[model samples]
Target chain A: MTHHAPTNIPTTGPDDLVVRGAHVLDPSSGLDGVMDVRISGGRIAEVSENLKGLRNIEADGLHLFPGFVDVHAHWRTPGREDEETIETGSAAAAAGGFTSVVMMPNTDPVIDRPVVVSGLVRRVEGESRVRAYVSAALHEGLKGERLTEMRLMKEAGAFCVSDDGLGTQSSGVLRNAMLYAKDSGMPVILHCEDHTLATGVVHDGAAAALAGLPGSPGSAEDVATATALVLAAETGAKVHVTHVSTALSAALVGFFKGSVPAADVTADTTPHHLTLIDELVQSLEGMYRVNPPLRPEGDRLGVGEALRDGILDFVATDHAPHASEEKYLPLEEAAPGFLGHETAFSALFTELVLGGSLTLSRLVGAMSSAPGRWVGDGAGRIEAGAPADLALVDLSEEWTVRADGLLSLSGNSPYLGRNLKGRVVGTMVGGELVQDRTGARFGSRA
Target chain B: MPARNLLTLEGTSRADLREVLDLARDYASGTVDRPLAGKIVCLAFFEASTRTAVSFELAARRAGADVISLSERGSSIQKGEGLIDTIVTLDSLGADAIVLRHPAAGAARLAALHTEAAVINAGDGRGQHPTQALLDLHALSGHLGGFDELEGRKVAVVGDVVHSRVARSIIPAFRAAGMELAIVAPQTLLPLDAGAWGLPVLPSVDDAVDWGADVLYALRLQKERMTGGSPRVPSVPEYARFYGVARRHLAGGAVVMHPGPVNRGVEVAGDVVLDASSLIPDQVASGVAVRSAVLALSMDVARSRVAA
Candidate 1:
């Protein structure tokens, strides 16, 4: 019943391992050629053609890229662990070839104070298999009210600030937040929604009209994007608009990319928004109900183009997990979001890159180097001095996505029954093998 | 085709609809009896309902099925029991059929996924009420001579089209019978993408009357659609002046219909509700026979499955 093919690494294995004969695709180094990589002391020891070591891992006919980094993800820790705990979420990320993920701050008490941020960081260190970073809420309770202690949160190891599940509706509060985030050297992740125009359960178009449900217009996102761009421009903050859904939002993000400094204004799109469209809501199923709900085909194509043209900076999973009971409720009552961390790369590689809409380098850039730059971690590169965070994928492997096969507590992925190309067969974080799909070596008890 | 669960009227074939209406006629004329005698029917009303609740209880008993009534106020649901838990409990108690009404859209469909009992949707908030649409069809057939005569005829659905599950169900049900629909409502009450429906849109009731609408299906105007309401249409008197079906509009020989509990002076005049041309009473009467036919059809399917 497991999607992984029963490969394992020893529990107390040494970091002196070598990967042989694999096509290494590193966006940071522009090295899209076959090479052997040697991992020692939790870093890349060598990247030559004939690297030799005591324990050699054979990897012929595979593409090795940097492990994925997601900047906008909802792991729902500290509360709502029944949906996804920190360890389970990190395990899912490791299985999906993600080495580092920034968790959203919309949990039970909401990750607002420095105490909460520090506590989560310690918990992640003790329990998580992958590097899990926390993002603090910009407001005290994510109420869009008073600001939290941004500098204190940054000191406590929070890399970003966001009121992700809730929108920062007040421009005064948002402007002040950007100003403070710029001072603290932390990026501000905007959810980008105008509540006044966001009353609809579905996209404010043919889907909503046909179902007789309330409609949320594309203009809602456009209005919010324009507001955030103006604020980013005003405060000179590193503003990253997360889950950009509308074409107009993508256009606004594109228009602001070069107008401001490269890092000052950036945006990202999710895997679901780039592939699915508003028409999916016709099913009246809860799986299709996402915030900034899936827009029209034009918007889907627009974000795809944005990623290709570098208008959008990277891809984040927004991997919100909910109990099946919560997600399987009526469409109106069901919570929004899909299981993303486990299926993001496979779906995008099959539908966008291999389908001819995007290049493999561009896909890797969005999934790896770009998000790594957003997090400013030494995680998205393959160099002699860089961390040994890597993913070995079989581009020719074709597999169908199944809910039960995932490692997450909830299985609400939009690509649940899809046949996708490009399966990640192995993953390593900090010179430690976390996932091995070969089912033959080292911890192969199964 | 007759689906195992009657969640919505969409995609139902003309023959299946005719079968329901014909069976209803038999029940109304006292020809069919005790078809569901040994069956156990559970009436689970998670929302407040009058006609649908009472009629379904009477229908189940008249067909000789033992009935159990559960409402949100008195049942465990009031103590915060979930809908799925309640449905599973009823299924464990050997319920052969479950008639459900809830305030949330798609409740019946969700229940159908949880249990094997023949699920019937009495009403599911602004989503669908298949039985209501069937009863309305039965009453309309009686008024227009027969169901066959419904072909090429025009029926105008007026007021609050967006919030009306009745409209959602009736539109497809009537379309299946070869009947054309003229949906009349203010732009506020109409769905924002009504053009996609491919039905004729009449902005006012007078326009539908002039278009020779054979039946006026008036929906209730929930005081909110008035001037100060959420969607913010014109005032109550202004709505009555334009979209409401008054006594004067009834002079055009078009039959008036209301899914009862009507807004007397808002959507339809009080006198027009009980006028000689009103099918409101007959629509109420048709609810019982139509529900009985539905129960019988579902029980037949369940019995056949068990035998197989």
Candidate 2:
């Protein structure tokens, strides 16, 4: 592994190591108990009680799980690097216990062509602290008019195809894209929002009403979800809705998942959608402004129920980052997006699983095996011969989220000043202790 | 219970509204004078307005506060200065209270966050027009006997409720004043979340009159925005026929009101602005007294903060 230090922090070389006296959890392997795990040469060497290694780190009173797989995060590389880069985003992801994350294709030029996909893959291999996968735009330049060359993008190492920020409006255009995606076996990730219905910046409910801002009705997501699911079912293409914010959208996904198993349709909810309600958007600063905006309590609790009932497949932070000045503008003028990659797991674990809205196993599964399989990555599991991607978390630790303390360059987060319960103490990617309790730094070059 | 900034009436307590209303009553009766002397009030109107802007200036001047007016086109705002920059500049230039009227819903709150000056929303876009609602309260109170009489009274707010900042603010203010409120507008003019207001949505001005509403508060037609291509209203005549308030719709002893720049024939019947039962002028006259109370109320916060 090679390294690039964007921030001043000491980096240690790869070595045979053991994490002992910790609860090892992996939903994929059905392993949940106190154990010792050994890693060497970027691979898991052993997993059992009382294993010895050259160097051992005490992990007692900690819960160890497979490094989380996040399928939606905007690294903003190739352009918008001032907001985020693959290196900085990967470090932030690692800090948040995400060993692998799929980057969105909503960059300046957008990752539609094979060249961009290959370039991103090379950069991720060279500079990233954790594994990075790039999703290519379904339409060329994400214009929603012309289909991109899917086979070439896939060959160039694009994990999926998406027109994330812009929904493909024309049904014919979307149908063709789904057909091509089916042929290429690339999952079509939909940013489900009907632009005409999504007129405002906030949810169409009590919050927007009381705030007196224009309302983006829940029907926006419901309409788009229906459109995409119909296309996915028609073309037999694998479709995944990113950031499902409405109960109706979740119900549609649930219906499709239960009724049409061959459609290969799945959806992931964001931490902001799963935990925070639209009421929070009324009080918080422009940091809570986001696309497919924060929904009311009905949708918030609805998505929670969807997650518990297997209607929603997993959790992924739509970790969109914007420049501070852009976010500091008034609610209507400010650019939409906020910091999420660094706070996703902690916020979810604290608000959902620990708060009794979700079980520990389900949350781990959503973050790990489910999203891992969505991207076709052989990660999100802990077993001998499997990749040594892991996170050691102190569930009882209470810490307030602060901008000055986060690793991401962008500090826009609704969770600012909010005290959360779970903390990621350490993250190991490919047998390398990339981050620990001391704080995040670049990983090894060995 | 004084508001730190009058952003919305949603979280405002009854005590806070009462304090301002009582002071406004004193101003209306000419019993209060120069309460805000030695204070500085900056009126920053980023959107075009006449009544809200002029009344705030008059109120501040009458209260003996040094007042500065900043309009969007005439100021550095036209030279591309940001809202926060303009607010902070006013704060640094010694504004004790900032009266802002911008076209964004949360503009006043955003300004409040960036400046130490007391921020007041004169009228934010489709957001709360707190002082407008306050003056409306003053006028309605005088016409309906007293504040005590407001408890059982019914006010039907007709016309463009969706785009009316006045409507948004008045809904909660009137509700807090113990008045039963009903809305009469075309479905197009109603906000998608209008149900959240918890007010009865009446079919038309006629139904509201038939229902024996004591007051008919009409909002601006906003026809220029509401009646273009893909118009919210099909035609001006159609909307006027359905939601508009004519003289005949006014029941005996019933009053008519408009936050002015009223589309004379559209939202109200012709010559109805000067009708015996029309409280339109009284609403405008009440603006001076109510705003004087608002200026003093907001500056009291700044004064106490400095003293402490």
Candidate 3:
């Protein structure tokens, strides 16, 4: 986990965007050897080294892999576009080696029905170079009482349904949807903050009491996650926990590890929750402000252990964006999410990879394979038939997180000026070059 | 020869200062209970005051009243509203009483002429913080077993008195009670008219304590007013060497007092403030009692007029 100064290797040329593999490591397909991945039509057209002079990029001291998939995020869309938008958010996704993302449906026009669902899909398709999937809310505007037209929303192409920012207050409606979702083969993603119990932001503990700051109590996350697990167990439906920030959520994941049938539960934890502690908040100024506020030092280190042990599933960018002016608004009034896409790989490498709490195998698996499997994605593996959506990275490179050096449009990032030990050198979305490390330019490889 | 000390006050009387402390005494006992049910203590601090602001606000509320701490900052004052206009605005708000802290001496008295509501001086430009002086007296009387009487005691006033409103009001109380007084400070920090009161003004803390004064009242080190004065007191270490009170300064069973939010190791040693004779914390506690008394007495007088 030692990082010397990185070699100033030149970035990829326009003609040869990806290198022929020197050593390719794809944990999803259990493939680890020299392999070549090719580009055409913005989708994986071929995966052979001898597939005719197809832009032979140099692969010396580099690792090529699939672009990541993030299934849960509050883009702060429609309503609070100052925090994040479809174009800026997709650029964030692509910068972190994410080719596609499942956008949370808690915006101005809460995606509860097919019309709102189709609107977001069209917005992303129209404005973004990346594919964006919308998760329709469980109830109308996520009020948690009346259910929206679930079958109609699925027909309109929502991958799942979730009350992302808050838990469904009505258990009966949530149960009904889970059963219906089980029948339709669609999962229900839940945010897991029981409204009646959640009083404020930040983890409520002795530390919060001393500081006179309000606490986002653990019982709220515990009760919501437990409730969701029981509904998932009873209905035998697939459920995914979004932004799992508490220790009890990790504990509940362990508690329900093998207890139910037809219960395919996966969770994604964010980068901010992993590295930053409450003490760090005292120093990081205010950029560390986020939902389920930052955890205490114990919870911060506990998440690292959870990632290493594989109790937690993937380390998601949850890659939320916010404006500088909006973020500077005092603690109570500031936006809830922070930018993570540009800093995701570098931060993950610095913490899990360089810090020695997580392995390269699990990092790739969680970031790529696990998200792909939960959403029925074709990438996360570099096998013969898998799509050529890829992320070529320099494992030996040590770089500091610079705001001016990101491909994402938004300048708000929590890891601004943080020194990290790894970075994404190249990114291919469906065989098309979406991001290149040289000149840090973004274009299609097709 | 130690110089004789004199204190200049706007109202000029030893008897009047005793009346203030006597009223402060009744309030300190919590015996004078009146909610001032419909009364308002308008705290008009034109500048910053943390302790004074909070103490006055709490005093009004604890007696079953309400308080509206009008912040002078970011108000119409910034819009060129003069002091007279601000006073009129406060009067219109139906303030039962106004506590005024201004940068000019006599501003509180001027403010009183402008409004029918009673104006309590919360300290006007270092002119006279008479309430703080009365509370200091009340604290000394209670701690030293001299309640309702100060006929023959000795007090040593040390530290800055040249520009302190607190010193201006406190000296008369000791003088009117037929007690001995000692003004001890450096030449620059000493009042210019020290020889007029016919008492001793020793030049150092050790010299004052050696005269067996029954109480030592330490003035806050007034750095804010120490401009254009040469031969100023030395550095903190040198100040402590020449004037800062220590355990050695308690030459007898004398009590120690300070008007606080004290600067540690500057005007007084940290441990000295925590010593056996220090009534500093008790002085802060007495502030609430003194204010409640002021509010009640002022309200009663106002009420009698309405009844008449």
Candidate 4:
């Protein structure tokens, strides 16, 4: 079986332009410092000082980096369009400087069948502004019962298979799915959670106890992660654990990555998990509720350290969107997720980069090239002959995250009302300026 | 500043507790006045309850307030109406005080955000039952002669303390009232990092007695805890042998109190439930007076009366 790299369907044709004198930073290509990047036919034609093109846009003060690739996001398409549609989800992704986003298969009708995968791919092509890849479900209806037609789904343009929003409960079932996924050459993205131990709404810790909210222990995520890592090592299957919230789970991934070198086991922690703690639940806001619930301060620090140390592979937004009605209720009754896409970068830049714990180079790499490599095809770098998917950020610009200012249909971000540093002023997907907040002028073809 | 609502006793001050308990004492001594007259007090219970609902309703009526009761059985909540919508509806209907009992933690806080009315949390899942804590304090204080008499008193909270809103509310409230507290439960039944609460976790009810506990506060043990797929306790009889407060444990001049509807043979022995030393009935009686004071204070009625 052959595996195809996920495709991006840009609305406009590739631009013939040069981004002049921008402080370009691409960690993957080791390209740092001010450079003029010329784009031709949606590919980076050259990267050097004083590069000339048909049209030029001056970007002297901006910091340019490869557009972020989110390995995990939920568009909530086809079913809860009110919550988030492909158009809006992609818009939110673009607003956050994400040029490529892999949508989870937990949508209505469940992206389990080949038809669903193909249909979603087509919809994303027509509706999405960025390069949106479709991830088919590993289990039928995400019930953890039977396996989906992974080989057929890959044939239909599915980049990967996942049962996100729910974990595959039985180890035997997960092992079989992994084996089948290996045969299909599809990366299995897992939402690791042992349901029996994940019975509570918030993290099982001092915060949850004080808040009087039911606490779901971190062991839930840790146990499932261990199982998946063991199975991945045993089967040699490509496994990506999404939303690794617990410290032990991140350590387990590190252990497997070190000990079982041949095992293709990668993991990601959400921006919320890295920055926020379970103590936020003390406010009793339902918006704080999330799957593999927000953990203690130590877990947050550990996860952040793991991401910095490359123990955790990269960051994924788990960009779940829900109507305000779903989020404004009590913690137990509210839906467990946060609108993650738009706030991912700024929240990280402010909390980690500026906080002196993590470097901007490492942060950019994790958000861009690191996750970009997982999606394949040299997608997340600004080197020549690479896709011109890029973002122009103003690192010094500070803005408060207001609910009404959000691009996603849902305004349930934990960062809402908090002032954050750094802003993605411009985002380009396939040489097209899908989001141009910088208001820079492009000269006519010369 | 006096609190406008009684959500939880976690941050409540000694002065606030003293004011409420003192007013409750006056209320018990037949100080009858229409403190809540002409005010619309809405009792919105989305969960099942017997004593809390009845006591709150009775308290509002005795305080001369116009009561509007809404339970899940007969209310719009039964039709999948969310707690926020119900709270909004009550607020729109001129509810001056919204007494909420919901199965979701933080329900009252969520309700309070949407309404101008004062919010009193009757019970919100395992979140808090502040009034119950206050009433337990009132009963303990009254039985021991006065509030000052509760100083340096040791109270042992036994049973499903993790799932008990009563335990959640009382632990803080009692501690603030100068009562030393210890938790008595198996490891499985305690909250995560129970040590963070700064209270000792006694191994057994007998150990609690040996620790010189003046009051054995038995929390109601749900039968589902034992019979559920992941049983918290090994068996009912086994749980009784350890955490359960029997007559023998209370023989050291220690009073037995329960946030009632107790399991006869589980958390407390059948004989000890109505034993001479049992303050269970007094706890029930204190509910009305304490809730009356809570309603009056939350509505600012007691403030005006005290000033007068």
List CA RMSD, all candidates. Answer: 4.8, 4.3, 19.4, 1.8
What lDDT tens digits, residue by residue, belong to model 2 across residues A246-281? 899999998888897767789999999988888866
Q: In order, how many clashes per candidate?
A: 2, 0, 9, 0
In terms of TM-score, the best-performing candidate is 4
Per-residue accuracy of model 3 over A1-446 as CA lDDT, tens digit each: 11110111112223333446546777887767676655544444456664434456656577776678777666777887766677777766777788667888888878888887767766766676455677888888788888878777877777788887767877788899788777665778888887666654445553343222344567777788888888777777888877787777887876676566456677778887887776544221336567777877777777767766767878777666667755553343356677777777778878777778778877888888877777665747766555566787887888777777765556668777878877787766655556676642232222
What local lDDT does model 4 show for residue B54? Answer: 96
lDDT of 2 at A354: 81
Q: What DockQ does model 2 achieve? A: 0.54
Error of 3 at A219 (Å): 1.7
Judge candidate 4 at residue A209 and give its lDDT: 83
For each prediction in turn, the share of the native Cα contacts (below 8 Å between chains A and B) that it retains comes to 0.46, 0.57, 0.00, 0.59
TM-score of model 1's chain A: 0.95
- Recovered share of real interface contacts in candidate 3: 0.00
Per-residue CA lDDT of model 4 for B14-46, tens digit only, reads 788899999998888876576889989999999
TM-score of 1: 0.93
lDDT of each: 0.85, 0.83, 0.68, 0.89
Question: Against the true structure, whose DockQ is highest?
Answer: 4
List, residue by residue over A67-176, the lDDT tens digit for candidate 4. 99999999998799999999999999999999999999998989999888888888887898988888999999999999999999999989999989999999999999
Predicted structure 4, TM vs. truth: 0.97
Q: Over 4 Å off in model 4, which ranges?
A: A1-15, A440-446, B1-3, B303-308
- Distance from true position, residue A176, model 1, in Å? 1.8
Candidate ranking under TM-score, highest first, comes to 4, 1, 2, 3
